[model samples]
Target: MLYSAKDYQRVRKEKEELDLGRSQFRRDFARLLHSPAFRRLQGKTQLFPGHESDFFRNRLTHSLEVAQIAKGLAQQINKRTPAFKRRSIDLDLVEFAGLAHDLGHPPFGHNGEHALDDCMKKYGGFEGNAQTLRILSRVEKKIQAAIGPSDDICGITPEGIDRRLGLNLTYRSLAAVLKYDNPIPLRRKKDTPLEKGYYESERELVEKIKAHVGVPTASTKFKTVECQIMDIADDIAYSTYDLEDAMKGGFSHPMQLLAKVGDESLLTKLHEKVAKEVPKVTPDEVFAALTDLFMLNGADTPALEQYTTSKMLASDAKMRSEFTSELIGRFMRGVSVTHGTGADIKFSKVEVAREIRIKIESLKHLNFLLMIMSPRLKVVEYRGYEVVKTIFETLDSEEGHLLLPDDLQVMFGRLTDTDSKKRLICDFVAGMTDRYAVEFYSRLRESGASIFKPI
Candidate 1:
């Protein structure tokens, strides 16, 4: 087998049942599927708030879409490449990567993440990618170690250790989601709002993952094929689906976005970005690409340059769906496997064709600017930042561990180290969904708060 037995080894050794027929990766997927962290995703924000319209995708739906795309992409590569056909990318593994990819995004999306990072500047800075690793290794309460009768509600820990084992997932499963390998610093040089590495708390587990997965200990970078596919799937999803939400929300349409073509500054920003990513694409090529991509229905190109209001909604639901489907198909056609640095599965990288990537980047930046940066969403984003920050502060206050739920409170009370305690509070606050975060903040600070409210 190309993958060694160590790849399937879990951190805490336990008696295994007879194979019966399920793959280890499938078990990993099942574990994540049934976890509270995964379930919380449904109430978390994606491109827009879930309550505004059920048609808008939440984090849960977006994750499911990513898993579908990642598995499909893996199949496409395996079917086309002889080497990959011989040592096929595990479809279940890629799907698990996709599903677990966003498991660490706090309530209110990036806004919430930023709030948590700012709060943890002195402790290990918070990052969604890093938090994902933390959750898989230690945060989730699937397995607990040997503990006193008081600590274990069920019994003296089944794992026979003295720590909480997040999921006791296989080493390969942990490696699949280890997006950024570096341990996050206590304080960044620039104090960036977000950091892209794992927390110090999971440092030991991460090292074990690398050793078990056959990645060189000295390697500076590490990203498995499945993780790359999951990342690409995530990009493809938000870029297309978020645009669908915008159109459905009556925000703007393709032709209406032509107005952006007139903004030389914005176009230059986009041109530089496209040029950087796609190389050799000129400013004129960018302008032409924009017009070619969005100038549909034989719409007069020159008039749309003057198009302003979203009221010019020239497309219907059928048109939007067709456009999105065609775009997604184009992206899929662009994918292939290529040689890469590092060891084992990390030795390969997924490449999206330049032309298709150009379209993807264009559409992504357009969605980010037009929808994510829109004043309409900005108001909510600002509110999200405040809510998340407030909740973190309240939970970290004097005697704050008292407010945590019984399960979290038990963990928090046992920690004596300051950093560990603060991290426990950070985890408590970061695990909330958008709805829950709002309710939490309201109960703490809002007037006429009900004591009957349940977290």
Candidate 2:
């Protein structure tokens, strides 16, 4: 509602208008849904490794869930809040943000991301959020034309001008996906892990986006209310759905977890993990919360024993589905918006209730402890790290550099500096899906396949 019709306009106008009876936000959603980047998410890892099971959720499905939750949140806000009821939140824009949020994630999820970051340490660092911005603004293909003389032709130039317009997304839609405002530092910091932010190379474009979206120059946290909604929806989907995946895979059982509710060591670990984001959370609070949620009826026995002995709650699909659905509904109802004026704006800050936040955080911690950090997953993650590292090294070497695709070869040749070339290499490897990365690695190391084998 803070935006005007002009703010939803694309960077490059279409030659002939085709009124599909869709709003600008809906069109933005369509553009992303049809993109190759979004499609590649089907092959990218979500919680478990992609190759591990056909039933596990991939990045594509995860994004779809996020979009649904985001739209639901937007609708809830519009129905409940007075200010939103007057101005109305755009459901399409919120959905667009959620769908586009993870478009830039590399193969193998966080493990692959860490590998790419390590490879790019000497160059500008790699962050999935930063890559998402880059993909939207510059990397993904878009319409183009020669704006200048033919003599200046270079990489990605059909004529004399290189028109890498990406999706040419509208300002408000772009703002909704600009999850972090800070720029990654040129030099690596020894004391901390690589921070997630926009790339320094995209700084001017980011500023342009902010200006168009009417964000104040001096605001410390530049997130828009729609972006905040998308962020919370992402958290909700991750906390609830990943747990469902683990349960289906039999990696975690609710009754078993309930039995461990009083285990001091497990509770301590959960507390430590949760406290990283919510500093004041305690072990007892997390345990009590999970116990309350998972325990069925007023059965007198310990939850663990009851779950083990009782056939109804343990294996019932309906029960599990109902529990997840109820949690999502509860969290959705917890969302609230605050309106500000003047330099401050209406619907400026969106928040979930403190108790709901803690519950979601606890769910996330349980997922992390029970599934993501398990020893079996660690082995797969390490192999993923090696695969990404080896592939980058092979392509970066002088002999192997010759084997790059023609387009990348041209881009690499045009960039003279070491860091620039390295960054391009990072881009190439980071765009790969999990299966592609593994296949490429196998071709380089084990298969000894034909030279004509396409990349």
Candidate 3:
């Protein structure tokens, strides 16, 4: 919140060419919102396809919601805090970061991310967050470069530094967009094991952001409070929106979802897994725990009081752990209490709103386990990987090589090493969408669908 549109330094050399009405940061961030990559988010999955149900939120809608929430948070903090006001924290930067945060998510949501990460393990790996950064700064150029720029696009000249590549964002704007503070290579793999942040390929850009913005990376991890706000906003949207999608798709009704948490079979599984000392007496407490978790609301004082009271019962470590798992189960059922704003998608409230965010994120690990990594999802992932693999192999063949870009053709023609070629092949396939991958694979294999226009 320290910097503003006025304070942001321009990345472009032509200060005289700069538009007086819009600041350099604002202009760059605005371009991202209007980008084809940003628009492609509409076709990408959130929890499920937006076409699957009208009630569900797609990636585009979700990003718009996050942007609104982030801007609201910025305005509120700036108004309340004298330091924020003095520092001139631009709402546009926060809004832009929120909007562009998830632009690089592949098809099939996090399942696609897992598949890509596994596929690209030797090639510096893959991460959704890192992919998003890559898209804004690089990958989008694959398409944009093929087509010449129009008046709608700003500072995009093919010749000058490949300005078409990155969002050409100011250092501060890009920094605001980075939710995770730690760079990939500097991290100890065993110290904290999570692959949900920026990638090693992005180190140079990271350094540029740090140096230009005058921010320090202390404690080996550093995130601005603004980034924290955007991260929490993303969390709130993800938890609630996924639940909404499930409900609309008839995956789980709220009543049945609540009932299933303490179901007899689930209780048996929990007891067996947790190995509670007082097995006989703990089941009822567990039932109460499950109920308190699913039914608890944090939007009102009574709900907060109930949540607090329920937590008081978790005095012992075993009870706490048991309760935590039960809460997770409820979340995985994809059921959530509605606040009746008709999916209004604003996160502007102060006191109780923060608590809602806390409750949602508390179950993130559970959500990850149940829905994200479940056998059903993995089956789909396997299918997606097969599609990518087949496509990559076909494209590398003599017949398929004809479809490639000129640079790719020349590089592939000259490259003799299998490893380097395979990496390039992965890059090509990684850039394809679910439909594109499937279509290309089908055509190459002479399979079910027709690749050419049918009469």
Candidate 4:
């Protein structure tokens, strides 16, 4: 095992009276499963907007699928590798990481994430991954604040001062989700894109988690073997299932992709785009992967009939089920582990083949070009940006403080720093669901509405 028994213990002491026979890892999974942050994922966007159709997946369903894939990948590695067999990976920890991975994504998906990042560029830039760390460490309410006798109690804080321990999760469990260890820059750099990392405010807490997990203070590596498994599982789920959702929503079909695969100009564009990340992935390799997956050459009918017939085939429930299952199995079986030479290292690192990795990336690029970059979706993204910006501006105004929830208003008053106030407002907006954000925006713009209506 990568971690010792002590690493599985929580920072805060467990209640003696409530002690259960369940393992510590299972307890960590249970804590994440019951969190409000996890529940809110149901209303957040995944591929398509959540309110658009019941057919499309929201963040919650995606997380569940990712968890399933993560556990399956862990089992595959455990069965295949001798090192992993000797010191088995914890299935529960892998699942916990996958489930908790996307808990920080704001409403409207990546579009909302970009907008929030842009808004908070000067106040320690926002990123969904960083927000995930924040949620686990300080946003969600699981641990009670350590209080002083004379201090005034506040929302989320039992005492007037913030203690910043949200779930107080076990170090190993927390380490599984610390996908990025670097801190978000306090100032934006010229010509650089916004990136995902932990918040600088939580630097000390991250170090403490690392220490408890037995990671050396001077070690440069951030992710553990379990974290790597979860990351790959996330990629597998995103590439395959998001394509499934897109196909179901009439965005793209395998036959259409088959046709595109043969187009030299389009293939050139795809190669160029993907090579920006993976330079060794050749155009022929991409074409071969697509052809193998879709059986492109086997379709002999006329082009129009092929398009219509392929759409019908794509719409078949049984075919979609089998296709996704096969894809997931193929990817899962590709996982393998490599042991490090050091005598102190107890666990081996996990990896997938380069071909499989590139194939997954190719599928993601196809999804991006066909669904995400579509003009129709861009309109929705634009409107979502306006909604988020408007809400932030409204709450930031002097008189607009009255419109905030009583708890937030109290928090705003208690926090005197400009950056802190902005962060509080950003949190309020970021916590909103897709439908609630629209509803809130509508309520704000209305001429007259029920004064009793709660925000």
lDDT of 3: 0.56
Please, what are the lDDT tens digits per residue for candidate 3 over residues 367-447? 443454556556766776666656655666666766666655655565555444554555555555556556666676666
**Judged by TM-score relative to the true structure, which candidate is superior, 1 or 3?**
1
Candidate 4 structure, TM-score to reference: 0.91
Ranked by TM-score, top first:
2, 4, 1, 3
Ranking by lDDT: 1, 2, 4, 3
Score residue 74 of candidate 1 by CA lDDT: 92
Q: Model 2: how far is 445 from its true place, Å?
A: 0.9
Best by lDDT: 1
Reference-based TM-score of each model:
0.91, 0.91, 0.68, 0.91
- Candidates 1 and 4 compared: the better one by lDDT is 1
Q: Which stretches of candidate 3 lie over 4 Å from their true place?
A: 4-7, 10-20, 142-165, 183-194, 217-219, 263-357, 363-379, 393-401, 405-428, 446-455
Q: Which ten contiguous residues of candidate 2 have the minimum total lDDT?
A: 153-162
Cα deviation of 101, candidate 1, in Å: 0.8
lDDT of 1 by residue, 201-302 (tens): 788888888788876434356777788888889888877888888889888877677677669888887778777778888777777766766766455545
Q: Which segments of candidate 4 are over 4 A away from where they belong?
A: 16-19, 150-160, 189-192, 216-219, 261-265, 276-279, 296-309, 341-347, 447-449
Assess each prediction's global lDDT (C-alpha) against the native. 0.80, 0.79, 0.56, 0.78
